[model samples]
Target: MASGLCENCSQLRELTAHLRKVCREFERKIRNVFREFSECNCVRITPERSFLRTTQELPSLRLLNDDETQLLSQESLQALNKLAVSENTGLQMSAAMHYLHLSHLLKSPLPDAFMEPVMALLLSTDLDVQKTISLALVNLLVKNNVCKELVIEMGMLVPILELFQSGDSAAQCHSCACVAMLASSESNKDAIVVDGIIPLLALAKSYDPRVQQNATWALLHLTQSDGSTRILCQAGAIPVLVLLLQSSDSEVQFCSCTALCNIAAIREHHPKLLSIGGHYLLKSLLTLMLSSVQKNSAQACRCLQTLSKNVLIQEQLMELDCVLPLKALLKTSAAVWTEPAVTLLSALSAHPPNNDFLVSEGLLDEVALLLHHHRSSSAIITHSCVIITNLCSSRMGQQAVMESLCLSGLLGALLSPGLSDETLLHVTSCLNHLTTWSEWPGHPLNLSAAITAEQVSGLVKMSGQIQNSLLSCNCAAIISKLEMTEEIIGLLRPHYITMSEYLLVFLKKKDVKFQHLGIVTIFNLKKDGDFSSLLADSELEVELRKVHAQTEETRRLLQMIQPLSPSSVNP
Candidate 1:
């Protein structure tokens, strides 16, 4: 038994040695092929034949048969395992490239063993090899948190940032992408920032569009962290990103818009961005916001949302004629587009001056329609309510909102099920502003839409049903306003001053009421003979003398008393 065990050990060692030899020979042949390809200027190698390319284009992963996929995965991992540990530089580069290419094809995360050698290869001095490795790392780190953790743990940020700082544009692009992917993992964000990735990416954004796009993406990711946004702004990333907003590449435009969005998210950066040609950026984004492309338009709207937070920027945007385009977007049937448009309009409306533009552009009706159409979507409802609430800030906007039939929409929103607390706040606040118009002494809106007696009674009933305090208060106020209207007073005249037994008993005991009744009768003597006759036998002289003695009380009472004029008594 001992002899047999020894023989088995010997065979195992022999098998290991044999496998190593095979890998070495295969590595040699692949290196020769790469050398030959590089040497020939006219040799055009399509990706279909082999992964090698003069342009270093990204590898396309084809679907493999189930059984074949498993076989290839196992064999390729084994080859990579050998090639990764090889001392030869060519072998290491090829292994990294293979890892990059195969990662897209694999169904699972790359094994832990593959990280050490690939990370080590990032230290190579050869520019071509460094570019290849950077590309490999970029592909590996994308949305792959495990790989990102590994990369972070290996302390690869400095090397990666250095590559981006000094390498060619292509290398810098890949390095920026890798760094951005690393920042995608929340745990690694601070580490990447600490390693000075922000300034490097800010500078790299000045390169060609591709590099600028990736750098912008990295800056965008980094800015998501606390304080990193200000760091990016301080590093002067906003102007470069703003400049890229006009790039013909949709990706460049998308990334640049999103980055500036992040910068503008910080209220402190608002002025800085505006001072650095943000108006031009706003113009480009406003134009792109209505683009047919969903991503381009969506990103543009998001950026506008950030820019609109600045009251000054909002004014600037209006000056650029952004209102019309935004109005057009507000009219889109797509909720995806309408949501941000509504959000922006809501922001702009906070400044009273823009309220005029919003009204002049006829935007309230579109917002009102959005509220009714997307009643089921909480986000849409919230945004629409906020817009209406802001639009109510100015008299002109309020008039426009009332004319747009948004008052009913707001009422419906107040009763909507599943309405968020924010939506409820805005809805109640909007109603408060709209109903308060009656409180405005001489405003046309005060008497423009008189509430009927039935509506006033209904609102009183609604006040009882409403559990929200703001809502109940506004409803009660509406009822009070309606009761004060001439039409409502006429309809409710019999009820307002009914001569019930309870009132008669109460008035007899209260001397102040008796005096008030006497003064009121005297004032109505010319307006109605019957009212004067009714009080003639009540000792009007005595009550009038009492009212005259309490001068202050009499003056206040006289102000409260109104004669039974024909307009009120007959209506």
Candidate 2:
């Protein structure tokens, strides 16, 4: 963090680090020699001036026998305490350097006493003292988490936050780094955000690259708080973070992008972030993804994933034609890109415009790839099913899915053993959508028969599982798409009681769509009269007679059903 040091100063930098780790006796001898040298000199020796003078005179060191020397002796801790508050600017610099060195070299938690000097020197006029102490606090507080509450007790965050507005760039950079560490702790999150966030939003736009980078990182950590999103958005954090998305540094882009994602994740935060040229943020993230900055690309997709949740942001994404970056990311050999890309595609597919575009570009291929490659990942499988479900609404999507390997993968995902219910719901929903214009000898009906006949025993066994509404509904839905031959009907005839029960429950659903799905599938299976007789032989008609929730569709099905035979005579 000590920038602008001369070549000799850089060499002396190693000696300065070494000087902290030497034995207590050697430290005493060095301090005595230092005081004598300072007193003997006509010019008061600043730490920087002393360094320049010492770098010339002391060129060699006999490596100390490291047998018993521990870092930072008791006398050195005493001298550090005195030097930290000394009026001499040079002494403060030396203490600040030792602050950094001791924090790094010591094996344990930094001593509690060292924080006193940190609090005292925070307001120093000397830039070196400010930068070095800020960096040291970052080591002690951020890297080690030694004094988070203690820092709050000392109110160190206030002076640290001020550095962004009032201190030099190096001070701002390290102060920003320090704030990021503080913001990561739960106890400090609310207190830090109260006074600290605005400067971070402001400092993110600083012309200094390091300042911009650290400020962006700080913003990323600040977002770990659930409350920070609104504060960040209201302070105009979005546009500035979006600008940082274009930074030449990939790390800057990654941090800014992830920060933008955290803000964008909450739906209520969308209007504030999107209303002010949010479209450009979407565009820049996509551009970075296409440019193949791998880390940036991954985070950029995450930003896209979170932003796409808002329908309005989805509209903007549709305009940007995000499918290019989506497919590019999906096709990349890296497994890391699969989940985010498909997840974004799933969210985008909810919007009809984006859905159709994704279909045209053959985004189904990516969905199929994820299904095939990441079957063990329920999230990947779930989102893949959602993409298929959404895309199936489009006729072009239907043909694309049917004509390619995607259909096989879709079926494989659906029947995948032990798939979670959330995933099973998506897979079943996709099949229901795929059958909207169901035709035999083609995509799903034949595909269903080929897959279902192989598992008819599973289907029938599943049909008895009416207690599981998803499995029962999927079985009924799959039957609706089958050829409905006597063979299929007979296969369903064994679970006669459970099938009729499933239909009755389905008919009673509040949504008319569910009622229609239930009645229509029951009517389709009525062909052989065996399954129909199972219904006719039950008390279903008597049950219907007592119900008042029947819609026109349910009534129409009953009119067709009542002609089968007499109702069951059981109690």
Top-lDDT structure, candidate number: 2
31-119: candidate 1 lDDT, tens digit per residue = 68856875565544533123334212222212222332542454454555554555555655766666555555455666776566566
- In the range 1-571, model 2's lDDT, one tens digit per residue, is 7579899998899798887767676877886885676556554456644543442232121112121123344545556666666777876786677666655655567667757778878877777788888887888775563868878778888888878776588888999998888877778878877888788888888889898888888889877677876777776777788788888887788888888778877777777666665466667888988756777787888888887766777787777877887888777666677678878888888877676778888888777887777667777888888888778776788877877666567666765677776776676667666666667345543444545444555554554465676766775676566666656665656666766776677666675555666667766777766766666646665544434454556688887864633455543
> Model 2 reaches what TM-score against the true structure?
0.70
| Per-candidate local distance difference test | 0.64, 0.71
For model 1, what is the error of residue 437's alpha carbon versus the real structure, in angstroms, after optimal superposition?
A: 4.6
Superposed model 2: Cα runs more than 4 Å off: 1-77, 165-168, 186-198, 226-228, 266-269, 353-356, 414-418, 432-445, 448-467, 475-571
Residue pair clashes in candidate 1: none
| Residue pairs with clashing backbones, model 2 | none
Off by over 4 Å in 1: 1-82, 85-90, 105-111, 124-136, 143-147, 162-170, 194-209, 379-395, 411-417, 432-467, 475-571
How much is 351 displaced in model 1, in angstroms?
2.5
At residue 506, what lDDT does model 1 achieve?
A: 24
